[model samples]
Target: MSSEAPDPLQHIGAALFRPLGVEGVYARTALYEDLVERLTAFISRQRDRSAEILRFPPLMSREQLEKSGYLKSFPNLLGCVCALQGTEAEIRAAAERYEEGADWTRALAPADLVLSPAACYPVYPLVARRGAVPPDGLLFDVAADCFRREPSRSLDRLQSFRMREFVRIGPPEEILAFRQHWMERAQRLAAQLALPCRLDAASDPFFGRVGQVMAVSQLQQSLKFELLIPYYAGAKPTACMSFNYHRDQFGVIWGLKDEAGATAHTGCVAFGMDRLAVALFCVHGLELARWPGSVRAALAL
Candidate 1:
């Protein structure tokens, strides 16, 4: 290995964070909340005007996850929710002991929940159970805490974070138009933020041999594109947002049918909330004082 000293985030911050890299950040007494709040409002504005705002718990049912095919497509990266089982008294005692430099023996079992990996994962069933999707469609503004398994540490990649998504399910044309519209809107949003960015077609890093083939096929097929920017001040750009078209995949699986009995088309514009914060920090700097006036006002910083 032609190795230099290891990347600091690699050894130090597995999930919570390290200093040299920012896979995670703890913005404690800092005033980034104003920026985060402004960003959240901005995301909601991008959704359909009539869209319902939905908030989901960080963990989801494993059965729900299975039906969603998350286990199949990304088993390696999935996080199952579990709890440490014990009597109430035992739990209290264990907690007390743990605080005293001891380890608890009761381990968590793989019960029902799993850490949700995306903001839209819980949406399919919610729409499906609502009976037939209207001819017009259903739109939602969803934000959730998400978790993922990662191999390397970079400013862009976080193991646990937040995501906001604008989701739509309806006619194919509507879904196509929604994704296309966001792709264009993203350009404007980036400009408004005054952050330099680029749009590029991207593919998920699938697993193993068959996955490699599928990833290559996906790249050739051009199913997804991302809006990337310089978060780490390096050559490789980080994806701040992505526009995805799922054709009939979720429609077929979740039975999200339009009024005409056609499998409803699904698409989403997803923003990596934490990554956006990172991008803003990297572009604008640690001090909020030097931020561009318009962007600062937009963020209410």
Candidate 2:
């Protein structure tokens, strides 16, 4: 007899996304679409500031990634592009081995690109090409389909997810203020949605002992914060939003300087669109109509 327990979230109708024979990749239903649309609309209205909007591709240059310092911190989660690199006969043999349930990826060679890990990563280098930032600084509304190697059954944690980020790049004081404003605004946004949430100092899920040290230092410096919401039964809340302050790291890496020739600081507020939608469902149940009137009006759903 099989002893595996059933997934507790299997019965979450309408709002639940179904995995497409993969551990983390999911197919969103109409209910999920409704949630994302409303969420996007609300963000657009609340974010009334002027900024450059950019939608980046899912894959980014591997060289750019290396320069971004992502490989140094998150080598485990990096998804490099690999493709079959052999003649017809070798490809046929590889296909047969794959059908026989053998390790077929051995024939693959790394490509020049890697799946993009964050929405704001690619923007830094591009901005650097334009030379020093202006006195007013730069604000970007960026969105991307990000990828990671995490494989989990939990609905909140996925290998592929959408991230919507409002990134600020400029002098220390301006960018810092931008992040602080969002931190406060994010809490109010959560309250408006009626989602029970809290802001907690956090760190990235770095790899290995060295990574642990980095994580600790990050927390100590208060460089990261997350908006956490209770999403599942008998479990701690999941982080649906992250606010990061990358002080001069990206600026130095990409040669992004302020008008005064000092390295520019960067800060971003990222929204986990999928996770936020699921949190709303978990908190209010699958029936959107039954949700609080204020919440419904806020989302305009």
Every model's Cα RMSD, please?
4.3, 2.1
Which of the numbered candidates is closest to the native, going by highest TM-score?
A: 2
Q: Residue 56 in candidate 1 has what lDDT?
A: 94
lDDT of 1: 0.80
Q: Using lDDT as the measure, which candidate wins?
A: 2
What TM-score does each of the candidates earn?
0.85, 0.93
Error of 1 at 201 (Å): 0.7
What lDDT does each candidate get? 0.80, 0.90
The positional error of residue 65 in candidate 2, measured at the CA in angstroms, is 0.8
Per residue, candidate 2 scores C-alpha lDDT tens digits across 186-283 of: 99999999999989999998889999999999999999999999876576989999999999999989999877898888999999998998888888
- Report, for all candidates in order, the number of backbone clashes: 0, 0
Off by over 4 Å in 2: 1-7, 13-15, 86-103, 232-234
